[model samples]
Target chain A: MSLCEKNIFKSIFDEWNQSIQRFIQARKIAAEDAADLTQECFVRLWKNCHKVSRDGASSYLFKLAQNISIDHFRKQQVRLKYTGQMASKSEKEDGQYLMEMQEFKERLEKAIDGMSEASRVVFVMHRMENYSYKEIANQLEIGIKAVEKRMHKALKYLSEQNILKKR
Target chain B: MSESEDILLSKWLQNKLSAEEKLMLEEQYDLESLALILERQKTLEIQTVSSDQLWDQLDSKLSHETKVDKNQSGSRRKLIWVALILLIGASLAFLLLAGSEKTIQSAKGEQVRHLMADGSIILIAPGSSITFNEKDWSNKREIQLEGQAFFDVEKGGSFVVESNQGVVKVLGTEFEIWESGKQMKVQCFEGSVSVGNLTGAEKILGVNDAIDLNNQRFSDVYNHGQLEATFKSGQMKYRAINVASLATELERFYNISVRLEKIDLNKSFTGILVLNDLEKAVEYLSKTMNWEYDLNEQNLIFSSN
Candidate 1:
């Protein structure tokens, strides 16, 4: 509302919008929703700008983004009920291969979804978002060793799913 | 694998493995499959939007909100002075009209759940509203619905749901009703329901039966498997449905518009679409149907590949 508040909000937005968006996207959220959620985080900050100091803005915004991601995760869990049986259709020339690939992809997705939140976040941040170990550590405020541990756990879990072995 | 091997695999994936470490890891475990998995994972990368563009959109939204806030505060100040003078009269009016019609509405991407006095539950879908006379509900069970809702009625008296398209009446049943513009769809998941259109054509739908009314004409009753409605389950399950209808479902579920270009609307599709993630849902649909799509903001364009 005030020029000072708007400036602070803009500075925070400029500093952290991409980070917040990437954080949510790394949590397996779609890009558009992640962008919307990132905007929501900033809007929330702007509304509470009177209470939040500029120095605390980073943590406040990231916390809001984390909470939003968690909420989205819970909602996705409720919505995702994988129960549809693939219909037996007349196969085209490459239908069998395509179906096999689709099945593997679904399995991998389910495997990732089944991982613990910590490990999944770390894994996706490194693998999908291309965040380096030290960068992930700095972003998550965890040690590099911790990031490596979670990434290892995620890889182990996926390997145990035998997703690649099945192929 | 041992802890060391697991760490090695993790490092290998991160490109943190040294030449000797990579050789040791490859000797113990196959690296080719890991490469394949990583390659597949690349295909799942999420598309990102430009931060500057999003900021522009948010800036406009914030300015509009600020304007609204200022107007609301100004109005509130004026209302406060007026309220002090009319306090007694307002209290009297409030008491006299305590139990009028109650309306429950859901905003975009929001679902509202309402519980009736009779222990029945109604789940209103996004961008929908329901109005009912709560005080008189015991005598006559009825509600007017605008968009879409899932009704889980307890067995007691006859329950009726009315819309501009038609009316649905049941003794006790679980059903979903969706009405918009000139189209309406009613699906009975539990007990039987009687449906009648504005043209006076009536039909009784049994469990798992569905009927569609377009322009006040009812389609022949069709039977589907026992599955929870989309509003209740957050998943859209289609069974050999046409592409046009699927597009409509996508629009309703995500609050987005889907446009078809040089494509056949009648091509049938059967699959389950999860409604939680719009990108994944669109990706699944396009991949399975062999269509290409472009999404911009809330508009999705699909074309034949």
Candidate 2:
């Protein structure tokens, strides 16, 4: 890549990649897979940087990352069919599994929405960017104790809501 | 789910757990299920990648692609661009059907530009929304809109944008479609677009062709379709639209409730709706329509002068 192109691409990546990762993770994609898709999203951004407008770039990156996760998730669903082939009839297990997944997702979304605004943003920063308690506190201009409290509260809320799947 | 257990789990997540503490948690949940839950927890709390490593990965991919396609990169670049978007769209559309409906909504005072996995681009205006089977997009290339949007569609298969009141079908074109409340307008800026109302009657619009629901006639809104365009400088431009129609649009644009009581229903105005300044909007509308408006806490109230 040219120096100019690299510079442009770097700035865009630096700005939106963390939020993109968070968005993917919010959809329940595994962290590693989200990272991979985040990279892919920026690579496409680099390839078509000229077409992207400054105001539109962030949303474009997010939508691209989201679409990648959806695609990746669908492929995983397809793979699961092979594993389920042996145990039960396709019709019965498929319907039940889909409903369970949907319900789980809805609950998780509700749990996040129920969190206080600061807690939710702090939680996203902690999870998406892996910020430490001190880092989140410093970034949000809050106390470290407050950060820890919010993080713990968010975790507890999700757990209590039974939003995360238990094996 | 005790406080102690929560602390331990949070510590383990922070990688502060020692060998023994890890084993203790493993013993508590058992190794397999514990591992499964921990693995799933990463989704809620993401694992961050160091920026340096991510940069290297991106650099390597860029170098590899450039080295391979240096000469014929123009056509190949186009192919990759189109393919990149198409792959994302086709896959997401698949999931939208199997998973749930995927809808794109834009809030007031914001515009979102979405590039489909196909090469088509959709520029959604504020206070507008659109829905389509994300899963069916690759195959069907159809979408439903609730506000106004300018679609720059790539030439290939027929793409369709449906709204509450009408449908727009096109083979490869650049056009703007507005569908809100009882107002629906489609303008073909480039190529040709076919529009069908709630009724089945259809009209194919060539370049510069515009058709409104209120007017059955198809006419020219722009001359020399080759001329480029830019957004309306934070002001929504309206030409000879009714007060009621203007009210609905202002409600969407400002994200504020507008009550047009005590005013002539048929009074029409042609002017600009300036964003960011309620005073300017009041000045413009009241002057143009000879109407008085009161800006309230939650709503804009209008009355006859």
User: Best by DockQ, which number?
Assistant: 1
Tens digits of per-residue lDDT for model 1 on B135-156?
Answer: 7789889999998898878788
lDDT tens readout by residue for model 1, A49-157 = 7788887787778777765664353433201212233233443236766566567667777788777667877887787657789878876665676678788778767
lDDT (C-alpha) at residue A135 in model 2: 62
Best by lDDT: 1
Give the lowest summed-lDDT range of ten residues in model 1 chain B: B225-234
Write down the lDDT that model 2 would get. 0.65
Residue B144 in candidate 1 has what lDDT?
Answer: 94
Docking class of 1: incorrect
| Span of 10 residues, lowest total lDDT, candidate 2 chain A | A74-83
Each prediction's Cα lDDT score? 0.76, 0.65
Q: What is the C-alpha RMSD of each candidate to the true structure, in Å?
A: 16.5, 21.6
C-alpha lDDT of candidate 1 relative to the true structure:
0.76
